[model samples]
Target chain A: MSIFLSILALVIILISAGLLFFLALPPKRRSRWGLRPIPAFSELVRVLGLSVEEGTRLHLTLGHAGITQPTSASALVGLQALERITAISSVSDRPPLATSGEGSLTLLSQSTLRAVYRLNNALDLYDPQRGRLTGVTPLSYAAGMLPIAYDENVSAHLIVGHYGLEIGLLCEAAVRNNAFTLAASDSLSAQAVLFATTKQPLIGEELFAIPAYLQTSPAHVASLRVQDLLRWGTVIALVLSAVLGVFGWL
Target chain B: MVMRSPVATAIAIGVGLIVLLGYLLPLPVLDPIRRLFLDWSIILAAVAGLVAILNLFKAHWRKISSSRERDYYSLFFILGFILTAALGLLFGPTDERVRPLIMSIQLPVEASLVGLLTITFVVSAVRLFALRRSWMSGIFLASTIVFLLAGSGVFLTSGTSQVIKEVLAALNILPAAGARGILLGIALGSVLTGLRVLLGMDRPYSE
Candidate 1:
C-alpha cells in the first residue's frame, strides 16, 4: 500500500509539472482560459477601485503565519493580491496599509509594497510604516487589528492567510465599521467564522485562485487548471476506493 | 533593476527537495539533513519573532511620541511589554509568579474574546440569511438552530434526549466530511504553491 501510494504521488506530481511546463511555453493559440468568477474577489476589485477613487486606504492583513512557515502559502497569495492591487492604486496618496502578525511577514509586506512602488515608478512614495507588525500572537494580532478596522480612513479590509477563531473579532470589527470586508483562511475554524462574519468569504481552494482570477497570469491560471484536474482525480479515486471496499476487492 | 538571485532559487529548491525526499523516502542519509533544516527553521523563526517584538515596541514608541489619538493605549502597551519582559527576565519564564502573572493577563481577555465569538457567530449566521437567501443559507441556519438546541440540552425527557443525541451524532458527520474535504484541498494547494516556489515560478522570498 505504501509503495502504491508513493508511486501515485510521484505520478500526480509528474503530471502536474509536465502540464505546468507545457502551459509556461509560448502558446500558438491565443485562447483564454475560463474560470468561474468569484464574487468575493470581484467585490474586492470593486472596493479597491472605490478606495483608490475616494483616496481612502485599503487594509490587507497577513494572519499569524510568518513567511518561512509551512502554512505561509496563503501569505504568498496575499502578497500576489497585494502586488496587483497596489499596482492599480499606486497613484493614491494613501497607499494601502498591510498588517501582519509576524515580523517576517511584516518585512515581506514591506518588500511587496516596495516592489509595487518600483514596478509603478512610485518608489519615492514608499513608506516602511505602511507594512506593520501588529502583534506576534493570534489573539493579540486580532486585538491590534480592531483599531485599524475601526479607523475611519480605511475603506476596505482584505484579510487572507492562516487564521483561527480570532478572525471573528477582526471581521466583526470591520463589519461594524461598515468597511468592505473580504476574508479567507486556510484554517477550517477560521473559515467557519469568516462564513458567518465576512461580507465576502473565499472557501477552501478558492483562496488559492485569487491571483489567477484577478491577474490571469499564465502560470497562476495553469496552476489553477492543474489543481482542478487533481481534485477531479481525487474524487474519482475516492469513488473507486469506496466501490472496491464494498465489493471486497481490496 | 530588481535583483533576482538565481542562488536564492537554487537554495530554496535544494532545501525543498531535501525535505520532500526526507518525508517520502525512508532513507537514513536524508534524516540528519532534514533534522538540521528543521532546527535551522526553528532558530530562524525565533529570531524573526524577536525582531517582531522589537518592531512592535518601536511602532508603539513612535505612536506615543507623535501624540496620536490612541497614544495612551500605546503607552499602556509599552509599559505592559516592559513590565512583562522585566518580570520574565528577573524571575525566569517558568517561575510560578510569572505563570500567574501571564495567566491573569491572558485568561480573562482570551475568555472574553471567546465569549464574544459566540455572539458574533450567531449574528453572522443570521446575517448570512439576510445577505444571501439561498438553499445553502437555509440549510446552514437550520443546522445551526438544531445544533444549538442539542448543545443547550433543551430536550430533557429520556426518550427525546436519546433521540436528540442520536441526531446530533448523525449531524457530526456533515462537518467532519466538510472539514476533511477542506483539509484535502488545503494540502493540495500547499503542495502546488510549494512547487511554484521551488520551480522559481513564484519568488516570494525575493523583492
Candidate 2:
C-alpha cells in the first residue's frame, strides 16, 4: 500500500511537471490562464505604488518557519511576493522592512533584497539591516514585531508565511497602528486571526498564487493551472471512490 | 534580463532528484547514499542556524549602540539572550535549573498567547458575520454555536439532548472530511513546488 501510494504521488507530480514545462516552453503562444482576482494581491501592488509615491515604508514579515522545514513552501511564496514588491518599490526613500522569526528566513530575505537591488542596479541602496531576525520562538517573534507594526512611517504591512495563533498579536498591533494590513498564512489558526484582523486576507492556496498574479511568468501560470487541474481531478477521484464504496466494488 | 546560473540550476536539479528518488526507492546501494545526503543536509541546517544566531546578536548590538528610540529594548534583548545562553550552556540543557527556567518563562508565555486565542476567535467570528453575510459565514456561525452547545453539557438530561448528541456526532465527520481535503491539497502543492525547484523553473536557492 505504501509503495502504491508513493508511485501514485510520483506519477501525479511527473504529469504536473511535464504539463507545466510544456506550457512554459511555448514562448510566443503561451496559454492565457486566468485566476480569480485576489483583492489582497491587487491591494498590495497598489500600496507599494502609493509607498513609492508617498515615500512611506512598507513592512513585510516572513513567519518563523525555517527554510528547511515543510512550511518553507509558504516562505518561498512569500519571498516571491517580496521580490515583486522590492522591484516596484526600489525608488522609495526607505526600502521595505522585512522581518522573519527564524534565522534562515532572515538570511533568505536579505538575499532576496540583494537580488532585487542587483536586478534594479540599485545595489548601493541595499541595506542588510532591512531584513532582520526578530525572534526564534513564535511568541517572541510576535512580541518583537509589535514595534515594527506600530512604527509611524510604516504605511502598510504585508505578512505571508507560516504562522500560528501568536499571529493575532501582530495583526492586532497592525490594526491599532492604522496600517493597511494584508496577511496570508498556511496555518489554519493564523488564518482565523487574519480573517478577523486584516482588511485583506489570502486564504489557502490563494497565498501560493501571488507570483502568478503579479508576474506573467509562464512557469508560475502553468503551475497554477496544473494545481487547479489536480484539485478538480482529486474531487472527481473522491466522488468515484465514494460511488465504488457504496456499491461494494472495491 | 537576469542571467541564469547553470551551475546552481544543475546542483538544485541533481540534489532534488536524488532526495526524491531516495525516499521512494528501497534499493540497498541507494540507501546509504540517501542517508549520507540527509545527514549532510542536517549538518548544513545546523550551521545555518548558528549563523542566524550570530546575525541576531549583531542586529541587536547595532540597535543597542544606535541612537534609535528602541535602543533600550535592544539592550534588554541582548542581555536576556546572553544570560539565557550562558545558563543553558553552563548547566546542561536537561539540568533541573534549565528545565524550570523554560517551564516558568517560555511555556506560560506561549500558553497565555494560546489562551488569548479564544478572544481572537470570537472577534474573528463576529467579523466574519459582519464582513460577509454569505452562506459560508452562516454555516460557520451555526457550526460554532452547535459545537459549543453540544460540548457544554448543559442539557444532558433532556430527550432533545440525545438528539443533539447524535447530530454532534454526525457533524464531527464533516471536519474530518474537510481536513482530509486540505491535507491532500497541501501535499499536492508541496510536491509540485518541489518539482518546480528540481526542474529549475523556480530558482529560490539560486536567488
* Leading candidate by lDDT: 1
**Cand. 2 Cα-lDDT:** 0.78
Give candidate 2 misplaced runs (Cα > 4 Å).
B1-3, B68-70, B111-139, B155-161
lDDT of 1 by residue, B97-192 (tens): 898989898889888888888898778876887666668678767877876776676764666756766777787688789889998898778778
Estimate every model's Cα lDDT from 0 to 1. Answer: 0.81, 0.78
Residues A1-250, model 1: lDDT tens digits:
3867767776777788887767656556545568886777788888888898899988988888976677999988887777777777878867888889987788778887887787777789998788888877788898898877776488888888999998898888887888888888899888878877777888898889987877736788878877888888889989999999999997
Point to the candidate with the largest DockQ. 1
Lowest lDDT 10-residue stretch of candidate 1 chain A: A24-33
> Tens digits of per-residue lDDT for model 2 on B23-87?
78666777787788878877776776677778878878987787755467788778878888888
| Local accuracy of candidate 2 as per-residue lDDT tens digits, A1-250 | 3888878867887888888887776667764556777777787778888888999988889999887788888887778778778888878987898888887788778888888898888899998888888778888888778877775488898888999888888776766566788888878767756876677787677777767877836678777878888889989998999999999996
C-alpha TM-scores of all predictions? 0.92, 0.92
Taking all chains together, the TM-score of candidate 1 against the true structure is 0.92
Best by TM-score: 1
User: Interface-residue RMSD per candidate?
Assistant: 2.7, 2.6
Q: Which stretches of candidate 1 lie over 4 Å from their true place?
A: A1-4, A27-31, A67-69, B1-3, B67-70, B151-157, B160-168
